[model samples]
Every structure is written in structure tokens, then in C-alpha cells.
Target: MESAIKWTSNETVLGFGKDAIAFLDTKLFSKKSPCDKKMYEILIIEPFYGGSHKVLIDMLYKALEDEYSDSKICMVTMTAKKWHWRARTSALYLSQVIPKQHAFRVMFSSSVLNLGDLIALRNDLADVKKIVYFHENQLVYPVREKKDRDFQYGYNEIVTSMVADTVVFNSEFNRETFLKSIKAFFKVQPDFRPKGLEGEIRQKTRVLYFPVMYDVGSHSKDYESTLHIVWPHRWEHDKAPEDFMKVLRKLSEAHCDFTVSMVGEQFTDVSKAFKEAETSLFPHIRHWGFLPSRREYLDLLSRAHVAVSTAKHEFFGVAMMEAAFNKCLPLCPKRLVYPEIYPNECLYNDSEDLFTRLAAFSRNVSAIKEVVADVKLDFSKYSAVNLLPHYVSLFK
Candidate 1:
């Protein structure tokens, strides 16, 4: 927990392992265990894509480093395709983003890695701690919903997470769903559910909400438009784009003076839902697709009156937080993790309720801000300051 490794590398040394020359505190360094001996080097199992996990990983790293600077972190990722983050010591096994044919060969194998600094257990690690984390996994995952690969990847996540010492979830919803799925899996293959495995899992399992990190960069833009609604989620089905399209069409028929911005990544194989929205509501859309500059996107959210999320499932809505941090009211459904993240009273269960709320917001936009203020979470509780201790306790 204390600063074990003296951080020596600057930004230039971080891109690749070229000069990953952080000083190792030999006096404190343990021979094998990467604990607080000399330097506490930790290995993080990165997500399939760059999104909320990236922010979580960054926050965890910073919070851990505030005291443990001598520590090292190695990220283990399946693909570097869309991942641009740099960790010199990371080990990439396979590109989960590539076609299934080519991916099978490169998918991560625990055999090839060096257990280095600390092997933060991940998918398919064959341990209870890691599997619990895998089971608790959530975050509007598009790849999981869009693809059908017999879940070789998910299987890997289950195995990897099971082996770790600490199994953590970003939200309680994610943790519970994972365990339920596992129990169901065991029902089919009863023998695989080891004798005392349930109790062990409960003991090791933890629900540690990830801290959000990333600047709400300076962006001052007063829109001429009266109603600025933002959908900052990815251009995918999880966001329920088809339903959002229907909302737009209904709102249009109502002749509401509103402008919508569709920000976030758009994959090559864009789904039917997004296509329908693009084709039908192209005129109403002001900005479409991902913007690399955080300022530009934050500016868009800041200026917007409402941040709408029509997600079918969200482990934790990072985009929702981005909007809320800047006073943009989140209008989301009372499903999965949304109610947990936002307010239970503010959630809408179906299209009728969502539309009803939207129509009301278009008339009294100030009500959106008022609603957000009323249910706004204590920022400190979700910050690195408070969250890190809870997270560290899991490791203990």
C-alpha cells in the first residue's frame, strides 16, 4: 500500500517498453511476489476496447501511485487495435477485434506470460477471484451483444478472474448477474461447481465502484438552439439506437424545437438501429460519430440541456457521468445499472415513459438540471480519494 517503487520514467518513456526504466526498490522488492518489497508492480487486465475501463484503469493506477510510486503496472489486453493507451510492460496475446479465424491463435494464454510485477487476474484465469470479476462484468459491452462467438472470450474472462486474489465489480448489478450466470452454468455441468466454491467466491468477491478520471476540459459554447440533447454512447444496439430513433421521430412529429448530437465511436459494421437513425433523422443530428478531443465532446455535453441514454444494459454509464459532472441531466431508463448510477425515481421503464419525460424536458428544460441536482451523487464518494481505500481493502 505504501510507495514501494520510485517512479522514474517520464511521458516519453511510457509509450513503449523502450525505456521502462523505473527504479526498483531492491530493499523492499520481494523475490517472487510483486507485493511491497522493493517496488509493487501490478498487472491490470484491460478491457476489449477503449472506453469506461480505460478511465477506471487510469483512476486506479493514479490512486495506487499517489502512495506507491515505486510500483509498476502491466496491462494485459486481447487487442491493441482500437487501444491507444501506452504501458511499456503490457503483454498482448491476441487481437479480440480481429476476425474470429485469426483471433483464436493469439488470444491470451497464461503460459506465455511472466507472472511479472503482479498478474492482475483476468478472463480465463481459472481462479475464483478472477471468475467473480468476469461474472460481475458490465459496461454496455457492444462486442458481447453484437457478436456470437460461443463466448470463448467470456470463458477466458471467467477462468482468468476466478484465479485472482481479489474479484471486484464496478457495480453491484454486475457482480450479482455474474454469479447468477455462473450458477446457471454449473446447473448444466454440476460437477464443475467445486464443493465449497460458492462460499469461497462470496468471501473473495467485492463490489468496488470504479472511480471516474479524465478532465472536463474547458469548453465554453453557448448554443443558439434552445434544446440541445446529447446521446454520448457508442453508435451501437446496446444504446438502443432504434428506440432512440423512434423517440426522435415522435418528437419531430410533435414539432419540438430541439437539436440532438450523436457523439461516440461508430464501428465499421454499424447496426440496423444506427442506420435507421442516420437515414431517418439525419437532418436533426447536429454532430455524429466520435470526437477524439475530450474538450469538444465535454463542450457538447456541457451546452446540452439533457443527456439521454436509451441503453438496454449498462454496468455503469461512464458517458452519463461525463454529462452529469457538467450539470447535463441524465434521462435514462430504470433498467440494469442506470437506476443504481442515477436516481431510482428518475428512471423510465419503457418507451412511453421515456417519451413522456422527453416531451416534458423539451418544454421545461430547466427541470432537467433541477432533477440532476436533486439526485446528484456525492462526488467524493465516487472519487479516487474515497474509492481507492475500498478497492485496496479488497486486495487485503
Candidate 2:
């Protein structure tokens, strides 16, 4: 597609529409920006991006590079041995790593920042336009609702996100959750009015759907897995493995033959949920524990028959998108971003609803098989190609 740059007396005009083309994942994930110039910079700070969100940001950065050559784009991330597998994998998606100087300066030793990629964020960040793309707010996450840590990380999240010139959320649900937490926290300060906080945050926040790779063009039209089910998420809380196990148990009882590949990383101490579910799941297991490599894991996704998530907390279901892109029937608890993930498919009511869906799916194999072919993501238009201009405009 040819891009036109027309000059006028007062300003120069940039062309709008181009050839309608969906880009390759490699192009989006390529580390360098389109332009080599560095007059200004667009910096994004996030805990992890290597998962589906990393792909989205890579594509967005690539697009920004193409449109705004004068601007330098950076992404910051922080990784430790303690971080989960999903976080580790997401960091790999970044073309570049955040510098060390930035991370050390940001922490005041006052609060523990939950999942804040302080190092990467400090490095990728420029003095120009600082954007914080928050996936989950530790301050108000489900775990936060239950207990407070020794050092409150929630305060750290609030302050970090507050520092950003612009705040971007993957979904409306996440933005609302964060705001509610901020509002609740503010009430404790009787003298503090916090009058402009809501308005200030609102102006910065705009829902930018995560760019995903759904290559319908040369997508592998062929799949060959004898017994395949995929779980390409982190082996931790939020994503309820128990709900999935229960459904699988019913399938086993019904003599609905199947095998599963639990393809995610297990973090820290063995989660009780994963531990407890292991006994029931041992019978039908084909692949267990975290995968060896990202490609190998994605390869498994390609062959899987179905992908399901019983998570109570998902800002945006990136793993599900990977499954859908790889041609898997996504069976999820119809809540949070799940509804937005697949508005086309009728959202199931609850766990029982998912069980009913799976029951019918097992009985009529063809019905489940068809989802692999028909899976589509036309709603999320912010893929690298579409979002490039926006990134450029933000810097401009």
C-alpha cells in the first residue's frame, strides 16, 4: 500500500485508508521500530507483554514506528526468577528490554509494586509521552479483595499508573475495577478531597483493544491432534483450574473420551488448586506442566481441539485469543472480558452453563470441531496495522 504525504501552506497532510491487510505475527513482533530517527520517544510500561498482549503492543509499536519516524518507542518490563511462566514468556515478546537505571529510580522503598515492570518500563520510557498499559491492578485484583500484603503493593500500582501521561486498558471492565479501588482507597483520607482524581484519570483512559494475531489468510487449515485440549495460561490463581477439572470429571463420567495438554508454567509453591485437580486429571492427561518453549507450546495449541478458561479474573483473555487463532474451540466462563472476547458466540451463564455446553460438545463432536474453523476476531481492529497511526498521533 502506497502512503501519501501532501504538503500545504500551513500543514502537511498524511493519507488515511490503505490496503486492507492483516499483518504477519513476525512483522508485528519484530523488535525494531519502522523508523530509525529519535527526536522524541513513546514509552510503554507494563509488567509483561510476551503473551498475547506483547504481540499486540509489538504490532502497535511497529505501526507507530512506521507513521512517526522522528519518535523513538520503548517498552519497559521487569523480570525476576520469582515471576510466573506467563510473565517470563510475555517479556520475550518485547523487541527490546528496559534499561536497569529506570527501575532502580522509580521505587521509593515505600511500597511493593505488584507485577510492575519497573526495569523495563524505566528503560523503554522516554521523557516525551509516558503511557502505562495496565493489564491488572494489584491494588484491586481479586487477591487484593481477600488480603493485604506485608507492604501494600496496591498503593504502588496506584502511584505508578498515576504518573503516566496516558493510561490504556485492554478492556472497560479493567478500567472500572481500578477506578473503584481508587475511589474506595481515597475515602480513608478525610482531609483529602480527591476532587479532580476521577476526571484526571478519565481523560487519560481510553479502551484500546489488545491487538491479536488472527491470520485467517494462511492459517493452518489443517490440524492433526488425536486427543488435544489446550491450557496455555499461567498455572496460578485467577484462572480456576478446579472449574475446568470439574467439567472434565463430568466428561469422564459420561465416557466422553478426550485428552488434555496443560501447557502453562507453574509458579512458586504448587497452587493447591492445581495440586488437587491433578488427581482427577491424571487419567486423561497427555501433556502436563509448563511447556519447554513458546514455539513448542504454540505448536500444541495448533493441534488442540478445544481451549477453555474458568478464570474469575481476566482483563482480556489473551490466551483464549491464541487458542482461537490456532483454531481451538474456546469454552470459557461467560463473564468479564470473556463476553467481549467472543460477543459473536452466545455467552454462557455460569459453570453449569459451561458444563452443559461441553456436554453437548462431547456428544456431538462435529459441533465442537466446527468452532476451530469458524473462529473469528473482527471486532478488535487495533492490530499493528490499524494502531500504528494512533501511536504516531499520540507522539505527534
TM-score: model 2 vs. ground truth? 0.69
**Clash count list over all predictions:** 28, 11
Expressed as tens digits, the lDDT of each residue in 1-396 for candidate 2 is 011111111212222222112232233332343222232234444343344444544455455555643134444433323433333333333323333223211111111232244434434433434556666655454554443432245555565566656676777887887776677665655675456566677778777666554433223423332445677777766677766788788878877767788877654577777777777778888788886555556667766777878887788776677677666777776677777667546367787787777666655556666655565655346354465556446455
Clashes of 1: 28
Name the weakest run of 10 consecutive residues (lDDT summed) in model 1: 16-25
By TM-score, who's the top model here? 1
**RMSD, each candidate, Å?**
9.9, 9.4
